[model samples]
Target chain A: MSKYLITIGLETHVQLKTNTKMFCGCSLKFGEEPNTNVCPVCLGYPGALPVMNREAVKLTVMSGLMLGCEISRLSTFDRKNYFYPDMSKDYQISQQARPLCLGGGVTIQTPAGPKRVRINHIHLEEDAAKINHYARFSGVDFNRCGTPLMEIVSEPDLSSPDEALAYVQALKQILVYAGVSDCNLEEGNLRCDVNISVRPEGQEQLGTRAEIKNMNTFKGIYAALEYEIARQLATVARGGVIVQETRRWEPDLGETQSMRSKENAHDYRYFPEPDLVPVALASEQIAAWKALLPELPSARRERMVAEYGIPEYDAGVLADAKENADFFEAAVRLCSPGLGKTVSNWFMTEVMRQLSVTGKTISECPLTPAALAELVELVDKRVINGPTAKELSAELFENGGMPGVLVAKRGLGQVSDSGALEGFVEQAIAANAKSVEDYRAGKKAAAGFLVGQVMKLSKGKADPQRVGILVAEKLARLA
Target chain B: MSHTLDVAYVAELARLELSPDEKRTFQLQLETIVNYVEKIGELDLAGIEPTLHGQALVNVFREDVVVPSLDRECVLANAPERNGFEFKLPKIVEDA
Candidate 1:
């Protein structure tokens, strides 16, 4: 492995976000009863015609646009022949000679930083039904049949697991943000097949690559690559050339095992699907739709960082989740971008924490962006201290309505009156003689405990930074 | 192009069980398919927009949901084994 360069390629199958199965009117819900959400076209009953699903196509084109692919003015579906129990039609309707989208790239952030992976093409196809195995006999569920699938294939540009992972993550992120697919791997909405081969450190020619299939998770992809690297290294040490074959990623074993010799497309006898006509997208139509795509997450992240002056890290965290980005934008427009960062901190740390505990999405939170904006405004204007504001934000997330109303209802308004704060500070000092002594002795950090005592005495309504400064000045006089 | 893709080789890679007679039949059929594909080669497609889907179709939809489903029963419904829903088959090893 040290002397050889591992070359990797990926084939990602993303299920489109559509209401019905690809060629049928059956609901695309994962469960309804085995074979329940299926009809003639999906079941491959004789003479049944497949009316092209426009939503699937639109989603595909949008995905293509997001990936920077050139849409093919003329694209068509073909029939891939096979005989599997799960294949109700004994063939898969797919694109072979021509596909919907071609030549795109994804830039991913790796330990080595951002690297772009070149995509060869993206094609549309139908998923096969599940082959249910039994001890006595085997049955099939056609519910998954004709489920819309878009296969995104990358060029042999990825050189390592890190690059491959970054590529997959970036591509998956784009697809998700495009609202093209949910990309839930366990549900098999997004599955990946990896092709790996090793070339001697300076060799110009490529090595024969093996295909690893059935990897259903990002973790599975990482483990599969690690195993392939080790396995290939051992083969090289033994002076044995690695064979090109298809392998199954045994996620539990964290290794890849040989499945079958990898085959090329000729094996499936790909031919233009005779039952369906070639789909020609009008230039004007695609042009109009292309103009409708929203600014992608990456661009939005950059905008938040550049225009809003929010920290890049915070912006990235907010933009990473679509809903969070929406909330951040809505809240940021109401207050200063600096306030967005602070509010983002509360949202990420406290709001998300509570959401995790209560199992709620940001959309499900009772705290509206307008209310969050209001709370942030109060804090930015020094109407409340950070702690009190955080408390109010949490209450707002748990409860409902405007922050100002709720703050009053909870009696948690911050106390900034210098005289009252001075009295509280005096009481706290009298009670904490040791801490006061420590503060006078130049133990600067001891002020925190004293400040905490004062805030506790004030019901946490005192502005913390203000209290800190007041306590430090008082301790200096005592010194 | 030095990278000649032999039809038979690709078929083997694809795990096809084509018979000898079928290979000859496919040889002709496949050649025709490739020839028709050459039409794409004819156009000076430089900067021409590609259509992802035909414009005539629309509104393909599925309800947003996760309906409760079978775990092993659906998997083993027609399986040819009883070893707790696993499909039992004749053991074949390729070490020979």
Candidate 2:
């Protein structure tokens, strides 16, 4: 393919983490008995008035704070007039002109290093129900209706499918870490639509953009863009011009097909909803939210690198997730800050290994921060050598335990005191007489025999390095 | 003067079967709504901020956790017919 810079923007619709749906008191849950939780307001029965939910607003503000976005002091809902069986009102009340959040970004780590994807805005609205269409008749269930959805629009900043996937992953990490949203794509909590346009290399102007929608997974987004890019390039090579349109990604075919033309059918009749008043937030209110803003991923990653002296790569991994960063911070506090490098290493290796195997987040991890800190303490205090400590750690981390208590109960104390270690070394030298003779006879591999004997005498608690050093020193006397 | 939608096509798209009298009456009402919007557009909005929604955008999402959905019986109870849980319908196309 000829050199072309692809510009991709994303519109992500996430169901808010509210206990109740917007405009109605229906329970904000995924799996419930069909149409059981719906009420008159959500069902669009005449004479029902929608009372807005306040918890939804607070959660949106929390999300905005996490993303470093400016909260709109004044906001109002508008009726987006449309007709569908899934929507009882035949119109959706959504944010149109001014949104709840504006001007925020998340930094996604890509192969090209850190890239900031600026979010244009995140707006709140109600979700439509699912319509099961049949050959002649159709069915609608209001189970999904009234569910609060936050539509986040990102600026046209990303250049590739990989970058888009990275951006989504980064956003999910922050949202989940913030406890703002669960961001589950499989459960339809978080869904993505990509706006992509490709321009000739070094061209100042952008090409016509195609909106590819309903790519439910990260891989689907990347694959859809890859397919669309190739298709556009092939069309241009054949002297065909690319027209702007809305496309749907077909995962089964690995292709993108145009759903509708962009020059057509896009005028949504947007008007303010009369049922609610315009929401206003004072400067003091916004300031209070600003103060509540957490250490974002970028800031936390930088601090982790500088304060903890962790390597930049490990810092990025830790900061990629909110809970992971929190876990790292907790470990640093509970253990010693000097153990930062070791903590990072253990988390990146053993902790990540466990999280992946059990499919759990650091927040949902069965192992606690204090428990892990104790394991690291075992190593530092020389109560258990590195290899044996790892074995104990795996056991403790997998099956939960207090390391200090476990070590005391199991009698697996390390022989770090030179006197105690020498006793074990002396026993090894007495028992491995042939090995000591082998060492004096110039068979250097004989020292390994003495080290093993020392380990057996110490009950696997003898430090390997110290064992080797003491074995070499004691073997020298035999010479 | 303002542009009011014909609504006939939109009605068709919605699979509605409206009579001539309803269409004519709706046209007049639609024109009234369009003219009202035209008046709003003509207002001096240079300093007035446009309000998107009454609620601030909340970044709410469910945990990507999946739970058991409604059983097929409950799901299809509202359906006219079903091939087990699936809603069955008439043949979309007739044989050539």
On lDDT, the candidate that comes out on top is: 1
- Candidate 1 residue B66 Cα shift, in angstroms, is 15
DockQ of the two-chain complex in candidate 2: 0.14
Q: Which regions in candidate 1 have their CA more than 4 angstroms from the true location?
A: A110-113, A260-266, A336-338, A355-360, A429-450, A466-479, B1-96
Q: Candidate 1's residue-wise lDDT over A1-479, tens digit each? A: 35888899999999999887777677787756665576667768789887777788888999999999999987878888875656757789999988999998988776777777888999999998876654545556678888899999999888888788888888877887888999988789999988899888889998888888878889889889989988988888888988878788877877788864323433676766766777678899799879868778889899888877778888888888788888878877887656666777767787778888998878888888888888888878777778777777777888868877867777777888899999999999999999988877788888999999989999888988889989988998898
lDDT of each: 0.79, 0.78
Docking class of 2: incorrect
Model 2 per-residue lDDT tens digits across residues A416-476:
7789989999888887788888888889998997898888888888888888888888777
Model 2 lDDT at residue A252? 97
Model 2 misplacement above 4 A: A1-3, A109-114, A132-139, A201-205, A260-264, A416-423, A430-434, B1-96
TM-score of 1: 0.81
DockQ per candidate: 0.09, 0.14
